[model samples]
Target: MAGNMFGRLFGKPKEEVSPLSTLEKLNETLEMLEKKENLMQKKIAQEMEKAKEFTRAKNKRAAIQCLKRKKLYEQQVEQLANNQLRIQDQMIMLESAKVTTETVDALRSGAQAMRAQLKTTKIDDVDKTMDEINESTEDMKAIQEALANPVGGMAEFDDDDLLTELEELEGQELDEQLLAPSTAAPATHLPSVPTARVPAQAGKAQPVRTEEDDELAALQAEMAL
Candidate 1:
């Protein structure tokens, strides 16, 4: 078997190479083959064209020789094309294999990371931590509620007592006002007359003449005239 021969040649069991490295090497080889294949095709086209030119010049022997060389070149070009196609197929397989290998490696790494985390973490620790958190939360809520409600949060207002005190004050003020002096104004005032004083000693009196006495005195004076 090929495996046995490979082992015998290596003198021991052979280790496999990385798939990605193998694929890169194959890609290089494929590019080289493509270049060589292109060169071979060019040579075939040149030989065929030369054969056509010879046939047009009416040289039968030269045309026949050109045709023979063209046939050989065509055969070589065909073989190169087949080789290039085979190499392309191999490159495709290697690229697919490399992708699959990368996917498997990524999945394996993720699985290993998960296993490491699981080893360090335990369910009992999680439960204990949750219980402590819940206890702390409940204590904080109780403290907040106690702070919100202090002692004796009531209004001090005695309505009946206040009303009785106000009425007593108002009665006392009214009684003091009533006992004060009255300030009523009189309706009218009349002017007073002064009495005349009498003379203390008697004096000679001159007779005062009335209007009739004056008329009689004038008639006597006229008769005397």
Candidate 2:
């Protein structure tokens, strides 16, 4: 709908002039008018100079005639300037219209392309594709998890049963350690007092003797007999 409007605004019959060609023609006319205006300005200045010279010579009639021609040239220059302004205004309007039409046409083309893409793609189709991908990903994850699990009948083993077996083995080891006998030698007791002693001097106390001293005294008595 918007494209139609722009086409109607910018389109022209073969007999009608296009905006570009019209702008060119206006530019040429403006240049020509400018040249004519410049020429007229120069002519006006020349007439003023002529009028000054005539006035210096005391020729009032010739000076008056030169002044009248200068006024006419000024009037023509003003008219040319007004014409140039009008042409410039027309060119600006045409260029603005052209720009607006081009902008709308670009927007219309983009809108059409977007609509085509929308038609070719559907929301349901997109959802289904995503769902398939998700399912495939989940299947892959399951396969990976299965592959990562323990192999060779290990997965069938029970954690509780293994712990019970380990506890029994530890118990048996503790029992064996408790039943074992120590291999260390027996310890002997030593008496603090001696079993026999020899008499000392009357002023001194008698010295105590150990069992080894008694054995030695018996051995000496046997040897003397």
List, residue by residue over 1-225, the lDDT tens digit for candidate 2.
998887799985468778789888999999999999999999999999999999999999999999999999999999998999999999899999999989999999999999999999999999999999999999999999999989899989998999999999999999999889876858553333333545577898766766777667666666666
| Regions more than 4 Å wrong, model 2 | 1-14, 143-225
Query: What are the runs in model 1 whose C-alpha is more than 4 Å off?
Result: 1-15, 151-225
Question: How close is each model in CA RMSD to the real structure?
Answer: 21.4, 12.5
Residue-level lDDT of model 1, residues 1-225, one tens digit each, is 999998788788557888778778878887887788788778778878888898899888998997788788778778878887887888888789888989999999999999999988899989999999999999999999988764563335566887999999999999999997777856442322232344545676655656566566666666666
* Residue 43, model 2, lDDT: 100
lDDT of each: 0.79, 0.89
Lowest lDDT 10-mer window, candidate 2? 189-198
Q: Using Cα atoms with residue i matched to residue i, what is each candidate's TM-score against the true structure?
A: 0.58, 0.58
